[model samples]
Target chain A: MTTVTQEAGAPFGAAPPPADGAGESAIVTEGLTKRFRGGQVAVNALDLAVPRGSVFGFLGPNGSGKTTTIRMLLGLVTPTAGTHSVLGLPATQALPRVGALVEGPAFYPYLSGTANLLRFDAADPTAPRTTARRRVAEALERVGLSAAAGKRYRNYSLGMRQRLAIAAALLGPRELLILDEPTNGLDPQGTREVRALVKEIAADGTTVFVSSHLLAEVEQMCTHAAIMRTGTLVAQGTIASLSGGLATRVRIETPDTADAARVLGTFGLADVRSEAGQVTAELGGHAPERINAALVEEGVAVRGLAVLRPSLEDVFVGLTGEGFDVDG
Target chain B: MSTVDTSTSPGAGSGVRAGEARRTPGLVPVAETLETTERHARPETPTPPVPSARERWAFWRLLGSELGLTFRRPRNLAMLAVIACVPVIIGVTLRIVGGQGGMGGIIADVAGNSLMLTFFALSFLVLLMMPVAVTVVAGDSVAGEAGAGTLRYLLAAPAGRTRLLLVKYLNAAIYAYAVTAVVALSALLTGLVLFPAGPVTLLSGTTITMAEGLLRILIAVGYVGAGMAALAAIGLALSTFTEVSIGAIAGTIVLVIVCQVLRAIPELDSITPYLLPTWFTNFDAVLRAPVDFGALREGLVAFGAYIALFGSIAWARFSGKDITS
Candidate 1:
């Protein structure tokens, strides 16, 4: 993944024009900016268009303004400049139909999971109290927390706490769900469960906007992703479009590494490197068969050749000029 | 040329299938995973549904939830229990001493009648104990939620900022009344069991019927409760300034102490009436016949002024504040 670091150029950082236009975007921000009182810009002029019905992943390394951006999108923090809309309405006005778990799961530590959900549900004026109890129970069960529904939040394991936060967000049918670092403290099994739950929710056509630093999580769960670094968007688009924009690399293992590198350099491939009896280069719009034929004609024995598509991690690092932590 | 790929990106569906398999061991069977999916897919109206009867009353529901949380907290309940015990301790100790040794003034008055002990305890607690108890509830209202990181959830629940602030203030106000009632009831009970019950002696040296004396104590409780509620408003305002509950709690207590300290200075007489604690003990006006409406009204107005001023401060600070916590 780190083998290539091509400059993404002007096409990056520019807003991804949604295929169906602004009407289909669940969230739209126009130069949204947030500058703290200490003169630090946490989020700077972000123009995001989260397509409707897409599992949009706001991927960034730690402290890259992921939480701050989520907070501003949810109206927990007001932006210093520009405007943003959620679910086709102003952020605050559309909040009733939006369910969010910001930063982490937070509830009355003394109250049971069931009671905490009841209180959160009560706070939503649009949520009918008539069905609150049943809804709360269903939410808990959906997150597989029924066994621990009566457990005090303070006594819960970290995974249980994370699940309960998800339960709270699912209390009502939300048109938009904004979750920041949803799987932060969960165990590996719990993390997989949450990823599945996110997919299930997104499959139902609810636009899910999830922010995380985990590249694997985003790669697996998201249909589209926006990469952030130092408060500005590095790149964003459909998962296929993001990776498709990068060049496919050609790797050949042979004893004539120097000859293979020389032949590949003559073919004008990018970043051709020879190491340990192997040679690799970005085959940008080049025929792999032609490259192999040229290598063989030049007496460079091509023992084996493989073409590799750059992963999302590679795409992000290329755009941001920084390696994102791939581990959970 | 054939392509050989080593790394395979996991499909989204495989994870869901694995999740489904693992979910079979969940305590409760997951039934609505598909049901809710269909529910969300249905093309619904663009506008929000008109609220049902139950939803219309959600304000009161949230208030009830807030009150339940406030009263149910072990810390707040412990403070209340301690407040109740102070009056009882004062009554039992007074009874043991039996008005011997010229303890004088309120002590001698309390020895004369059981009802006077209620007034004596109110005077003793209104200055410090009651303020501390009220501050604990009100001071922690917003700051505690922020400290625990629940404030963001509540705000995102779209608990309108103004509405949330109102609920916090009302919760504190209700708790203040609870504290006052606890003190008065405990004192009244202990005094009746230990001291003589009869017509009460007034500060004016006039004796009134036991029924009238109880009425005066009831009025005094209201007066003190109102004062504490006003103090709670100040606590709520301070609560909005920080994420740490202890900071707000201590800030409120320090303000009250500063007011009391200023009130004690003879040269600061001009500013004494403006201090919240200064009017706290003005419930003594209820002891006079026909109820000294002038003094009582002045104290009520002061309390009202404090509530109005600080309540606005809290609303202004809270509504525009960013919830980073």
Candidate 2:
């Protein structure tokens, strides 16, 4: 499936076969590593497989090698060791079909938004020049920047610059879109719009590999995610699968904490603890309703109760052992 | 051009609408057309059946866009404007000081014939001002993009590393020629309007017709342009080393100034032939009655050697560089 002949006939401009055995994953990296000068390991031996048509969020903290890895994938930086492929082809060969926005939006300050896009479009050897104008217009429109298209990039607000960067990635019909911190400077409403845009792009059958330190962004928009700490990948899987690994916690608020703890202990829950006026335990396959019913029958006087399923934030914190910016 | 042929083909001709339709379920039409386009426009070598004109146009398209960016930059335009004004200022100053007691060398010759001003200005400016202009453009070619963080996007646009390097070099070369032409034209116009126009006295004491004098000026323009192009190559090589454009620009200027300082030292005359600055004034060969082709050719060869050496250095450094910027 990794044979050259299969990829050679397609070139980069051609659409990658969506359901073929060779194209099942939009991106696959094996032991991809990058060690900078002075012996700084920015990215350790990491393996990543991003399924096609899935919105995969690459979650990591600042200085966690997310941008460095993206640079390597785009051939902007040479890897220290290992190999990677995009759309089942070598990164350079597959780059024409891949649109990327690394770090942030950058353009000639004197050039208008439209002009900057035109210059970028000209850079891609595969993009047809005949329809370049229309594609640039459509891209700007998609990102809701058509009104500001004629404005100089220097005059754009941070959010507009972020949107323009996304628009640049959308300039062509791409098989894979790699956006690092896509919503970094965007406001809340702008963030929501970008999230919707990602979902829209994913729905159109394009694989999206987005990197961000915002835990809520990944939890809300990503189907699958990989978490990185320092220079190593800590965890990776579908969002549900990752969250599923953590136990569901049961918290009950009552004046009779000791009685509630005894009651919860009777249900065979794990780590039952009573402190102050609160009793908490790992639900561990126990139904919330049944526990609530048993507590009432036992006259534990349950005032408030919450069966909390751990969010992706908790999963990330637990895996990396460091707090993340859960709000963006 | 095959743009007319292939673009008008039944499937590929429908341009914008087909592209717009691709967003929907009509991906097959766009995909089929793109495959056909790629089949014809294969990288490096177009298939044998593809029209040569289209291939040539594709080669120039990227270069054209690059040239547009370079020329449209206000900073570059301002530099060129300053270069143009240098000849005007020199010509006007020579005109006001016509036959003054201290007037000597090229200034006396310029006061006698209008066309001599063009030659004198080329000799005067090529030393530092012209090289500075070319260096600013060439040095900033890659590093400017790096500084502004646009180089990453350009490369990821998959502008092949080698091709981008070639385009940057060409862009700088074109600007170099433009700088030379601007100084020559501005000086020629300033000279003609201010001084008496007549047969030019050559360095060999032979008089040449106005048409021949203009031709000599054209030759000097080209020679100086070549010399500046060589300097541009050095600037480009330095550009590949750093993300700070000013560093590359200043480094190239400093190298040129150092060479000039070395050339001025009579004790170091043995190393004069190897220095780039020593050959820049070789355009003075045009001032002789029968142009000194031997000297001009030697200068050109030196320029070519400089270009080759620095160009390869730029390619090797840039192709393997980690574009962290």
What is the per-residue lDDT of model 2 for residues B1-325, given as tens digits with 9 covering 90 to 100? 3233344445544444444555666355656566556646644341221100112234367888899999999999999899889888998888788756578776788898899989888888988999999999999999999999999999998777898899999999999999999999999999999888999999889999999999999999899999999999999999999999999999999999999999999999999999998999999899886889999999999999999999999999998999999
Worst 10 residues of 2 chain A by lDDT: A1-10
User: For model 1, which pairs clash?
Assistant: none
Model 1 spans with C-alpha error above 4 angstroms: A1-22, A258-273, A283-304, A325-328, B1-54, B99-104
How do the predictions measure up, each by TM-score? 0.86, 0.88
Q: Give residue B3's lDDT in candidate 2 (0 to 100).
A: 32
Write one digit per residue (lDDT tens) for candidate 2, span A225-321: 9998888999988999999999999999999998899999988999998888899999999889899999999998999999989998899878877
* Candidate 1: residue B278 lDDT (0-100): 91
TM-score of 2: 0.88
**Candidate 1 chain A weakest lDDT stretch, 10 residues:** A1-10
